[model samples]
Target: MAEMKSGYIDYKGFKTYYEIYGERKDNGKKPLLILHGGPGDTHLYLLNYRDMADLYDRQIIFYDQIGCGKSNIPHQEDDFYDYDLWINEFFTVRDALGLDDFHLFGNSWGGMLATMCMLRDDTGVASMVVNGSPYNCQTWLSEANRLILYLPEEMQKAIAEAEAAGGDYSTPEREAAYMEYYRRHVVGCDPWPDFVQEAFKPENVGECFNVMQGASEFVMTGKMKDFNVLDQVKNLKVPTMLLSGTNDEATPFLIKEAYDAMPAGTEWVLVQGAAHIGNATHAKEYFEAVENFIERHE
Candidate 1:
């Protein structure tokens, strides 16, 4: 039987909650740490990954980053919610866990943060899995706009009108439009898994997202308006794998851009018929791909 433990860490005055499944003892395989999306989606949705320990025999770790889930959210200026802060937080988690070497799985915003962390330090990471994420917000926004065109005419018109009227993404019409896009390109699953639903809770939509990534997935009027690391990713030599859905908001083509920019041997997995959050609906395929990639790299 795998062991399970949970705890909190004092990270720069805030409490960051983490959970570990499987023993961390020398088991020939390195542990895996997961980073969930939304910048505030907590680690609940990703709890599905616990099976990695049971099925693959590798330790699995999950942490609800500060400002979400069980972690304490600090009341600071909007400026506090930036890549530098999140990057430092990532290192703190690693240091606290004593994870000298491990695999990483990052979804959506988490994937972007993982890429950023890799750019800062790749020596200790055996390999990384970036899921439904982008390296550039500008490109992501552009792609989202393109995807918006495929929505119904009413949705397209509502989106255009909302943007023209100061980008009100909260209107009922606007929200419906967003949901239509989400249903088709985000989760794509009829009844969202409970974990995915947990990620959509109000508290999960915290300042990190509000200040850093704007109100909607399709907009970019936040501090990360110019976030882009495509130019520098070529410097990374880490064995990496990029995972995306066939119809993900992250887009297969954009994922290809990052793949092309990575080291020569970087891997890519495209989940057929899945959307943004493949793990939410296609766990068997998504988790296996991750397991296979990490197993080989490890």
Candidate 2:
């Protein structure tokens, strides 16, 4: 088993926490850098990749983006939640760790961030895997609305009411209704996993989530509400693999838009019976596909 080492990096005076699983071996492959979802999500849920590092003798990296998880939180102001700030942090962490070669894996918002990073600089990226990410906020909301209609009529009503109240998902009925949508499109597992639950704890929830992703998944009243990269995805020159679940909020249609926009030869995969976080609900298939993709590129 590879030993896990954890540490913090100082970036622009802010502290970002990171954990590395498995020491670099002479396997001739670069480390796999993981980017967690949420404009504020922690890297806790991504711990599933630790197994891949240990078993495959591959190095895996996980980091809590600034203002999330174990990282230091900046002042709670909307101005602090800039997309370029996080993108710069990604490069800072990569260079700080001396990762000249790496396979980038970004989930959800992370996937969106990864795309932005690759577009900004693709020099060091050997390959990329985008999981359950949205290329356009409008498309995401449209698909989410479509999915919401599939919920029970009462639940749909509750959700609509909650959204109308400015995303006030405080009532038990409203919360339950939101969870119904989450279970169907977010985790796709019953008895929500501990790591998934941990991500929403008070300390784990960062200002970026509210400032960039809005108050809730269904709402888009944030700075990133208009974020769209479909027009520029074609600029990605790296070998990329796009992954999404059959029931993901990043619906197949949206994923297809990204896939079709990417340069030829990019891969697209849909994990059946899984939702947004396929690495958690469908670990076997998810890791197998990831490992095979990385190996093929290597």
Candidate 3:
């Protein structure tokens, strides 16, 4: 154990819990603020990166969003569940921790949030990295739905039948089928590790995920339905690295559009053998890419 420290910061009438890893040195190692995926997911899966705090001689800040994981979970009030609220909380965390300028890396939904944060303000980010992120919600829905169609006919039918029956997303058979889709697209290379499997279990918070990102990958009924940052990438104003795997659910087509839209100084790299979670799927290659990018910028 590296003797991690935990604390709570008050944000928007609620308390958000976060953990700090590795000791800060006088050499000015900027903290890496990590935003985990799943609007409702905790930071448990991202704990894998704690070593990066020491490896890169940097600090890693991992926090559970309001109403998820070890964070405060309230009921009967979904008004505070929007993405903007999360961004506000992120700023609060940054200011409270005195993170003047730092590195930012996020995956999946986390990646989307990181971009949002960067767009809002670059005062606290020295560099930005977006991994396996979607540029447009509509395009994501189209691609994800297409992927769903590639599922076994029987499994797809089972899911349709289950949904037709009612809101039975909790059914054992439906869960199994969903896991199959997740394995193929979410993790890419089959047989996800145990920590990834653990994340599959239902956390069952408010419908934050559904309200902010829809019920599944194939649907876009959330507030992000019209979200598109393609035109704004040129305004990034920060050194940015757009990374993705060939087989990612994000797909190279989407990532290429995003990269082309970025400012001229922005850079990109593709991980060959990995999928959406390329950082975890191809650790050495991924880390090297990250290290090289940071060295160039730093």
Candidate 4:
């Protein structure tokens, strides 16, 4: 394993922590800039993706978005956590690192952010890979409701009762029901991995998740409830690929909808038996698909 280089960059009066794995050699292929999910998820779970640096000789960069992970948290004002702030933060990090060419990879909410970045400007982005991203909130919620029906009857009842009571699904029973749904649709791994566990820690559960994503996956009581970029994706001219798991909350059906809205020639891949975080649960397959797409465009 290559030595990891970690540091922080000042972006608009906030500090953003980032780590770099593998050196950027004159390998022709550009470095990969990875955007993690959650408006609040740390780059910890995405550490698995650093394998791309080792296997494919690509420099892989992972960063904690402002107000999450090791980065400095700003005041949670009404105007603080919007799409433009994150998009600017991304370009700030890119410019600070002096990356002239790079491939963008974003998971879940991060995927939406990456798409917005491309839609804003593709001047430096060489290609993109969006994993389990939701382009339309209504489609996402509708699919989630469909999947919820497959849960055990008792679990379904518990979830319904909890959501009906103003999203207070924090009881032990409710937690158990949520986990049952998670094990099936969020992560297919039997025993959840440590990195995944770390993201959900009390201190690690940054305000962004609650403020941007709400209490649970199925519930949407946050500012991001109306976030939909389907109309803008058609203008994205960069070479892009979409990925989703067969059992993902961002189902293949939803991913296909986003793919259909993208400019023609965008690629799509669906991993079997994997859930939301396929890059973690199905690293080999995920990396192969990602590497192939990047190489084709390179």
Candidate 5:
């Protein structure tokens, strides 16, 4: 196994931590940056990418965003956490690591951020893979609510009632109700992974998510309330690919809408028998699809 090294980039005075796995090779493979989901998720969930060094002979960078994981936790909503803040942080980390041009992979929220970076036109992002992510938060939220209704009537009612009353999202009852739906639509047909469980910091997560995203998957009550990248999707100037699972909260309809809106030189694929966390649920198949996407662009 190759050694993994850690470092931090000072992005506009905020320190952002990142890790580099394996040695750089002249295999002509563009370095790959893996972005984890969540306005609060750490890069720990993406540790699996460390092994890809052997398969692809490219640098894989993993980092925890501010207020999440092994990174700096800034409680100030005013300065630290925002869409543009994160986008700039990505470029800061990439430039510090000397990644001139690279392939990008992001899951869920991370996928959305990756797309935002690609749209900047300043960053020389070579290609991208957005797995199980939607282009517009509003459209995706509607799909999530519809999927939640498919559960047992009792479970559906429990969720609706709690949200109506503004129940605490950190409570055991709410967690149980949400987890039931999350299992089927978020991760799909399996028990929650250990890392996924570890990543659930209810207190901090609730504040961060609610402030930036919303109250529920269906609720759009945050700074990103009107976040619609639909108009800009067609302006994507890089080789891009989209991935979604059949049971993904990022429904096929939403994915197709984004795909259809993209400029030419893009592709979309559905990972069979997987859901939102397709990369984890079906590692080999997911990685193979990603590998093909990167190779095709390279």
Candidate 6:
């Protein structure tokens, strides 16, 4: 087992939890910082990635963004969750940890946050890997809703009706229909791993997701609906590798859209037979591509 270190950093007035999964050394293998999605998924979902630290020379860092798992919930009533708040929170963690140089890996919304970091400043990021992430919120909405159109008609009606109703989307009918999409595009696993299940717990996605991503997968009515990083992605100088599953909710098309705007020489990999959480279902391919990208940059 890699040496584990856990602690908290101050974010506003709350404590943000973080962990490092390896003993730091002066080795050229810089640490890998992972960002989990949800504006709200906890670091628990991505703990399987500790292997990068345990097996390889790299250390793996995991942190729950404010209002996320293992961290104090930010003020929901005050509308505290937004892209700027999230991006700022990330820097606070990085600086507090003194990670002057590192590799970055993010999944789903986490991947979006990685891009936000590079957009703000690429100073300490050595390389970055984004899986099932979106470069533009509008494109993310279009692609996911497009995938929804292909679901069974019953599901289509349930989602459309529920979204149109714009009330509680967790109703039995709405949730039942969305589960179909979740199975097909989110986990792509018959029985989800315990970690994945934990991350999807209702409590795991709280006010942050409510304020940033809204209540349903079919639409993005939250503040992030206008978030788009593609225009600025073209100027990023860091080595970037974009990954997406062929069956992903992020959609191969949207991944390619982001890839196209990325700086020249950016890497793109599409895992076959995988979906949103490709790392869970297609670990070999998903991680090999990431390992290769990080090695090249190192």
Clash total of candidate 3: 0
Sorting all predicted structures by TM-score, with the top scorer first, yields: 2, 4, 6, 1, 5, 3
- Looking at model 4, residue 258 earns an lDDT score of 94
| TM-score computed on alpha carbons, candidate 3 | 0.89
Worst 10-residue stretch by lDDT in candidate 3?
A: 198-207
- Name the regions of candidate 3 deviating beyond 4 angstroms: 162-167, 170-173, 189-191, 204-206
lDDT of 6 by residue, 242-283 (tens): 988888999888988999999899989888889898767887
Worst 10 residues of 1 by lDDT: 203-212
**CA RMSD of each candidate after superposition:** 1.7, 1.0, 2.4, 1.2, 2.0, 1.6
What does candidate 1's lDDT look like per residue over 1-298, in tens digits? 5788999988768888999999876667899999988776788877788988888888999988787788848567886677787788889999999988899989988999998999898768999999988887888899999999998899999888877876687789987887788788887876788987977788665667777777677788888889788888888777889999998999888898888888888889999988987877788998899999998877
RMSD of 4: 1.2
* Pairs of colliding residues, candidate 5: none
21 Cα displacement, candidate 5 (Å) = 1.2
Clashing pairs in 6: 37-110
The C-alpha stretches of model 6 lying farther than 4 A from their native spots are 167-172
What overall lDDT, based on C-alpha atoms, would model 5 receive against the true structure? 0.78
In model 1, which residue pairs have backbone atoms overlapping below 3 Å?
Answer: none
Better of 3 and 4 by TM-score: 4
TM value for model 2: 0.98
For residues 1-298, write the lDDT of model 4, one tens digit per residue: 8669999999878799999999988878899999998898888877888988889888999999998888848558766787888899999999999887889999999899999988888878899999999999888888998998998898889899888887777898787888888899997775888888887676665788878878778878788899888888999999999988998999988998898899999999999988998865888999999999988877
Instruction: State the C-alpha lDDT per candidate.
Output: 0.85, 0.88, 0.75, 0.87, 0.78, 0.84
* TM-score for each candidate, following the candidate numbering: 0.94, 0.98, 0.89, 0.97, 0.92, 0.95
Q: Tens digit of lDDT per residue, candidate 3, span 1-298?
A: 3558999988767788889988777765667788887677777666667777667777788988776776646663556677788888788888998988688888777888888888889896888888878777777777776777888987787667665654366778787777787667677655776666665556634357766766666666678788888877678877889888876788778788788888888888888857776655777777777767765665
Superposed Cα deviation of residue 207, candidate 5 (Å): 4.0
Q: Which stretches of candidate 4 lie over 4 Å from their true place?
A: 72-75
**Candidate 3 lDDT for residue 277:** 69
User: How many residue pairs clash (N, CA or C atoms closer than 3 angstroms) in each of the candidate models, in the order given?
Assistant: 0, 0, 0, 0, 0, 1
How much does candidate 1 score in TM-score? 0.94
